[model samples]
Every structure is written in structure tokens, then in C-alpha cells.
Target: MTCPKPRLQALLSAWNAPQRSNAGFSRVPSTLRKLHGTAKCAEEAIDTSTRRHKVIFSGIQPTGIPHLGNYFGALANWVKLQRNAAPEDELLFSVVGWHALTLPQDPKALQQARMDMMALLLAVGIDPKRSIVFHQDHIQNHTELAWILSCITPTGKLRRMTTWKTRLAVSRNANDESEVDDSLLNTGLFTYPVLQAADILAYKATHVPVGDDQQQHLELTRDIAEGFNRAYKTPSRLFPLPEYMTTPSKRILSLKDPSAKMSKSAVDPNSRIVLTDTPAQIKSKIRGATTDSIQGITYDPVARPGTSNLLSILAACTDDDVLEVAKRYHNRNHGDLKADVTEVVEETFRKPRAEFERLRGETEYLTQIAEEGAAKARSRSDATLREVRHRVGLA
Candidate 1:
């Protein structure tokens, strides 16, 4: 029996769909015979199995001039990544000024700090041409995308974040979480991870170079991407799952308290080495650094943290292995090791310090570079925002 004309057309349309695209025409129902025979051969392509050099996205807060920990842990890796980047590779290095504002900050000081940070990044070899280096606030899309991601993110996840908990413990005089009311813990601090995820996904970054401490946040970024993709059911992956690129260096420890990481927030100024430290300041800090009355120097982080910390710093600065550095000072006393580490640090920071001084003097040039970088960043971010908006039905 012959099928009705309308039924035939319906069958034809169904047969033309992708599910039946691969079926042999002879086996297709007669109603879809004409449609099946007219189909083009499926594109035969080889799965090259080569991995794409993923886009790398990393950011630093515009707190102040970066300390030695910041230099060795993050900025140094950023320079190496950018220098070796392929033509197709994408890299974004942002000065996260908004993230800096989660805590109370003086307006004028924050502004100055942001400008100083941009110059320092340039002096440290973050080429604006190779990587998109800009202030986070300049690209409004970051906040816009962050708001959207926050909507879909579970409150439990934010509440469980280690960073907020650590900050609260250090800042609050009260013992329990209830003592510090919601006012003290602002929405910005609580939802900062979502914003961080937005920063990566906004650029569709596929690889992130971060310290072990930041691996948790990168995992959160992946979850956000997967959740958004599953929710929207997009044809293609909306965001690439970012992989972490870790450096071999262990966390740089404080000079004053070798147990703790070198941090800008340390109560003692001598605890951490600032990138802009003068030769005199470096010498004084090294001279006064806390070290036990140990007879010999060896790399023992657990037993003699002070000497070990110095050795680690030396190894990082000179790009030598820690074990090898320890062997160099195998039977030496603490004084010899400390003096050697101090010298290496001074020599390593010398060129960057000079560049920073030159860049700081040329304020006009620095301003121009920041503006140009911000403009380029904004253009790329705007495109991503448009696609995201369309996906979420905002468009």
C-alpha cells in the first residue's frame, strides 16, 4: 500500500536527520529512498590524537608589589609559560583588583597598588603582547559572568571553601562562626570562588598554572563548567576543564617562622622578602633571619626548618636542585648557607629591581601600557559575554 503524500514527507525529513545519516540507502525504507540516496558521504577524518596546547589563565590580586613567594610561586611560572607559548596558545594574566576589595582597603592606596602591580608584572617579563595582562575591573564581563555562575552554584560549596574559613579565623576575635555576623563575611568573600571560576571560564581557559594551595579552587572551576554544560545541554562543551600546571618548588617559607609560608600578611616585615627590597634591606633581613645554633647545614625541612628554608630559597632563585644545593653546603655552618642564599637572592632580583625603578619613573609609559592591555582584554571578554548571555537566554 502507498503512503499518503504528507506521511511520505514526514518520513523523508526523519530519514534526513543525523541518526540515519550513516545508514545504507538500499536498507532505508522506500518512503525515504530518494532522501537517503541524495545524502552526501559522511566526512572521513582522522582523529589526530594530538593534545591541544590549552589556554592558560591565572590571576594575582593587586595587593601590593609581589613578595618573593609571589615571584617564585606564580609570576615566574607565568613568564616561562608565556615565553614558550605557541602561536595558537592563549594566555591571560589579570590583576584581580576586585578580589583585593573583598577585605577593607583604602581607596587611594588600592589604586596606587594596582598601578604598581602592572608595572611590576611588566618588569618581571610578563609581555603584554604575548599575554593579555589587564586589570579585572576593566572587564565588566567578569562580574557579569560571575553573577550568573553564582546563581547556579550551591550555597553548601561556598560555605565549605577553606579560604573564607581561614580568613575568618585569623581576622575575628570571636571563636565561633556565629560571632562574626554575615555583615563581616560579605557576599563578595563568600562567592569569590565563583568569580574566580568565571575568570577562567570567561576566557574558556583549558589549563591553569597554580600552586598546590590553589588546586582546590581550580577543581571548583571544573565543577562549575560541568554543571553549566549539563544544565544548558549545549551542542559543544561550553568550558574546557582546566588542568593544573604545578611548579617543582615547594611553598616558600617565612624567614622569621620557617614553618609558615612567606606571605605579605605576616605580622613581621622581616618574615617575607619583598621584590622591591633594597640591597641594604635584603642584607639586614638576612643578617637578622631566625636560624638555630646548628653546627652544620643540610636540607631537613622537618628537623631544621630555618636552614632548610634558606636552602630552598636559594635553589628556587638559582634554578638548582635543592639536594644539589644542600650538597654544595654539605658540611658548612648555618652562617655560610645564609650568606650564600642572601647573595643569590640579591643577584637574581637585581635586574628586575632596576627595571622596576625605570618603569616606575616612566609613569606615563606605564599608564599607556595598562590602558592598552585593558582595552584588548575587554574586547575579548565582551565576545565571551555575548555567547554566555545567548546561552543563558539573557540575549
Candidate 2:
């Protein structure tokens, strides 16, 4: 009998496997195939022997220590994917320093943050042996491929990207006003989506674990892959358009201002819970979290963002449905919920915190892992780049 799938395996299996079209070519679902003629194609993709094992890829910025939102929204999902992946499957998690450069960062702090991020990835159970973990900047192929992809990318498409628009909107002018301004928008931020596409394309990633906010970017990646294939691929497809694998976890919000996502840039240190937070700190933050004066607890996110955020955190920690978690807290006051949430948060973060502290000091080991991972990454991309160079007449 087939073994049971991991909790996360089911979350991603729908589109992770490639589907065969009427033309007998395996591909990700595209607008042309789905909405155009050939309506008789198979609705689902199968993992045939001809197809390679799933190559899963995702990246995270090395800004600083990740908070609750970051953990639930992405990193925790990577750990689950690693634990569940087939032995033959390839998984690459990159500390994307290049993406971090979209915004200005302190030189020394950015350096430290990249190392700390690698340590944190290890702390959270990303095995270097099982999953390829590397610094994106260490592999020059990413930038080279990004530059190649950028040459064909249309400026109109980039400008139409909601991420670009949002970044421009959030960026401040000479003054600190957070309006829809573009004076400070940099070319890096504007073209980062192409780099993102290159990151996935370099690995020929079959499935990408992405959050809802990033669905558009993944769509753009698929578009870029198709564009390159149409322009360059002669007989066979060069890149397998990657499909998105979303997390089941709800978006965790800020404790201080439930309206916004939990951010490291928030003025209040208590706004978000970091993995390194001590038990006392977790307790204080949870206890001080902004909640309603309602009679009882519920998970109406729009109506009760604060209470719902705590429940979301609790549910994530316990691996339970947020609605079900709220059922147990309906009669409880915010104080009771806060106490329980605090305990669970502390328990959840305990091991990772200890591991990060221990691993952070092992600079030699970290460097070794980083170097080895970079080599493996380069090896993986060598064939793709070789073909890319030949197609573009640079070989």
C-alpha cells in the first residue's frame, strides 16, 4: 500500500505534479491550455518516469531575525516540505541577499543578518544534507540568469506588477510620509521580480511554496518561463513552469497594530514575537497584545483582528484549525487566551532559539555549509545556464 502523505504534502500535491496535454507534453496549467482549444486535455498532471522528481525552490530575504508572521507564512512550511519530500526530490532554500538589496541596508548589519539567517534556517530543521541551503549571491549564475531574463522582460509588465506598485506606494519620499510615492523607487526593486523568476527557473523548480501575497509573482514567473520557451526553446521545453504550493497557515498579524502585518520595523519591540524571544518576553508580548473588550473570544479576523491573531498563532503552534481553536476559547476571556498563547509560543520557539544560539557561534561550520551549498547550487544550474548561453548565442 502507498504510505500516507505528510500534512504538507496534501497541501501542495494538486498542482505540484505536471499534467500531460493533448499534445502529450507535460506542462504547468497555462492560460492558453486551460482557456483555449484542447479543452479535452487532462485536468490533473501525473508524475511519470519521463518527468524528473520535484525540484522545489523558494527564497527569503536576510533582513533580520524572522518574526511570527515569517515563521507561519513561509519558513515553517519549508521544514515541513523537507520532512515530506521524496528522497530523489530536490529542495533549495536560499538566503536571498540580492533581494534584500532592493531596500537600503547597513553594510555591516546586512553581512551579519545573512549569517544569522543561515543559522536560523538550520535551527528550524532545514537539513543541509537533505535540502540545498545556500546564499543566493554566492552563486553568480542567479544574477547572470536574472540579467538574461531581464533582457526579454517587458517594462509594461513590470510596471503592472502589484508588488512593484505596492513597493512604490510604501517607499517614502525625501520626507517620511508613507504615501503612494515613487521618487525613491529603485531599479533593483522594480526589476526584482525578474530575478525572482530566474531563481525558480535556474532550478527548473516544479513546485514553489508561496504565500497568497506572492501568487502574482509566481504567475509572472510562469509568464516569463513561457516567454523564454517561445523565444529560445527549439525542440523541447527548457524550463518547466513552476506551480505555487501554498501554506495552510493563516497570516499572522501584529500584536500592537492588528491592521498591519507583523513587522521588524515596527517601533514597538513588543509588536512581534521573534524566535529568540525568552519565555518572559513571549508572555509580556502576548499579555500586552491589543484585544477587544468583547464579551467572549472569536476568530472573526476582520472584526476581531487582535483576538484572531492570537488564535491564529495558537492554531499554528498546535497544528489545529483556527476556527476549532477558537471554539475552545469562546467562553474564555482575553486574559485566559493570552496566557495559553504565551505558553504555546514559548514552547514552540524554545528549541529553535536554543539551536540558533548554539549554531550562531559555529562560524566555521556555517561557512563550510554555505560554501558546499553554493557549489551544489552552481552544479545544479550549470546545465541550465549552458543551454541558456547557447540559446542566446553566448556559448
Candidate 3:
């Protein structure tokens, strides 16, 4: 009934998102054509960032509720990247259920969460027509590729990754996994990096939009791709190492505890604002948000984390840089700062929340979208996997 956002039409066409133009190609195959400033895609093409077609892949796991941390950290950033992308780019957003299994989950809750996340993606402006949005488990190709890649990936490298506790982002001290004793770390948690590498190389994605926390995982993906290339080359190479396309969004911390990243798993309801929170809930959470007794606003992350987090949230909502937003609040009190942050966040989540509620209950509609997404994803990865098998002498 209504026209899509200008960026939605533009996002699927490019990677690292250059500039959007009028023309866009269809969804891509694994071997995609040259992509520039677009969300379009083709198949049986190489994944290279050097003036060729661009394939951008990013994954989200359905572990629990989708919070602002997930939004600013990954989801919102993906949409931003999509909008600015060249028309030739291919954007693949996967609901990575397999990755969620790294931590134990109740089956029923996890299933609902998967749908909730899918709905949230669409609600937040990921168009099924433009980008390939599918559940990771729906297409077996990801796991198959993961198995092949795991053979080449080293255990030392897996052990070395700092963000292994949570595959997405690290909330604790960057250098310390020592807080959690060694025994609690599961095998899936240990090797999920290999799976993550597989997720990228499966479609031969060129650029991944991620926060700084997952930088090591991206490096590992490139390493595994190089290893696969070294092990098995079809003609010259089978895989083009993907690059990291960093987003401008920063990591949002918890309202209750500024020391940690905002989380869905946090027991306190007021600790993090869910994407689905009502206006009253958002306002209440912001009002109760942990801020220093210190006067006047500043953007010092270390000295004023609570205050800084508020500034970061406001900046992200307004699409302004954190420091620039801080300048606006220099002479203001915490109360004034909170009120504005609350107003903007409520504005930010407004339409998406309403859309999510409408779509979440539409089981048939959701299934249809998932099925189409899976079909598109499978078609793209089929080419890459066949080449992988042939080079490995499995075919």
C-alpha cells in the first residue's frame, strides 16, 4: 500500500555500500557478477572486493529477545549498509539458529525466538524482495560448508578467539575468558568460529558489516578461506576472501549495569530495553537508567559509562556521531539528557514495533517469506558447494 524506504530499494544493490543508483540486479548466485552501489546479485561468481561484484553476508542468532544492543550492534547497522549499497551488491541476512545452539536453549522458546527475530528483521526494514533473508538451518549448505571448513581451521586459532563466549560481541574484559572456567566451554562454542567462517565462505561474501568485537572472527573467516583455496582450487581459486565492512554504530551498554553490554538474557527487565517495549516502558527504563551523580554531560566512556551509553544511544538514534551529540549536552543535566534520549528511542522504535506486532502472529506469511528466502539462499550457495566438492574430490 505504501512505498518502501528509499534506502530499502537501494541497500540490496551495493556492498560496503557505495552510492545507490536506479538499476538493481536480481538476487545473486554464489558466483555473483560485478556489484557496485546496489543490492543486486548473480551466481557462480567469485567473491572479491576489488571492483568486482560484492556479496555482503551478516548473521543473527535467535537466542532470546532482540534488544538495542543487537539493533545498534548489528541489525540497524545492516539496514544502514543496505541503504547505501551499490545496486550491484548482494545482501544476505541469515537467522543463524545453529549458532544459537552453542548455548543450551529450551526448544519451544528458541523456535518462537527464531520467528520473532525474522519478524523483527522485516519490521526494521529488511525487504525479502531485495535481500536474501533465510534461516541458517533451513538450507543445509551452511553446515555442509562448515564441516568442510572445520577440517582446515586450526584448534589453536579457535582457542585464540576472544569473543568465543558469545559469537556476536564480547561484554566482559576483551582479554579475559578466564572469568569463566575452562570446563564450561563447549565444543560447539570452541568451533563455532569455523561455522561462522563457513557462513561467510558458503556464499563467498566479500564484506561483512560487524562491530569491532567480531573482528577476530572475520580474520579467522579470511584465514579459513585462504586455507580452503590453498587446499582446493577449481581453476585459479574456489573462494575469494571476504572483507569486514565496519558500521558506524557503537556497542550499547546495559541500562542497569553500564559495565556490560545490553543483553536479552539479563534477568532484570529494566536492564535492557527490548525492541518491542512500549513507549511507557521505554520512558521508564530511560528514567531509571544508571547515570552518574556527576554534573553536566560528557562522552568519556571510561569515567562516565552510564552517561556515555545514553549519549551513544541518542547519537545512534539520531544518526549523529557520539562526540558531536555529547557537545549538545555539555551544559545539560542528566534529567534533560535522559528525556531527549527517551524521546528519540521511542521515535526510533515506533513504526518497527507496530510492524513487528502485526507480522509476528502471521504464521503463514512468515513461513512463505522464510521458504522463499531459503530457496534463494540455497540457489546461491549450490554453485559454491559444488565447486568445493569437486575440488575436494568428493563429487
Candidate that would win on lDDT: 2
How do the residues 221-322 of candidate 3 rate in per-residue lDDT, one tens digit apiece? 867876787677647776776655666677899999999888776768898998889999999999999999999999999999999999999877766668
Model 1 compared with the native: what TM-score?
0.84
lDDT of each: 0.76, 0.82, 0.80
Q: TM-scores, in order shown?
A: 0.84, 0.87, 0.84
List, residue by residue over 82-146, the lDDT tens digit for candidate 1: 76667888889998998998888999999888888888899999998888888888888999999
Clashing pairs in 1: none
lDDT of 2 by residue, 1-395 (tens): 23323532332233235421223222444533552235433232222324558889999999879999899889988988887777888999999999999988899999999999999999999999999999999988999999999999999889878777465444442223345556667888899999999999998888888887888888788778878987986866688767667787888888999998887767688999999888888988999999999989999999999999999988887777788879988998998888777766776787799999999999999999999999999999988999999998999
Candidate 2 segments exceeding 4 Å error: 1-52, 168-180
The alpha-carbon lDDT assigned to residue 31 of candidate 1 equals 16
**Best prediction by TM-score:** 2
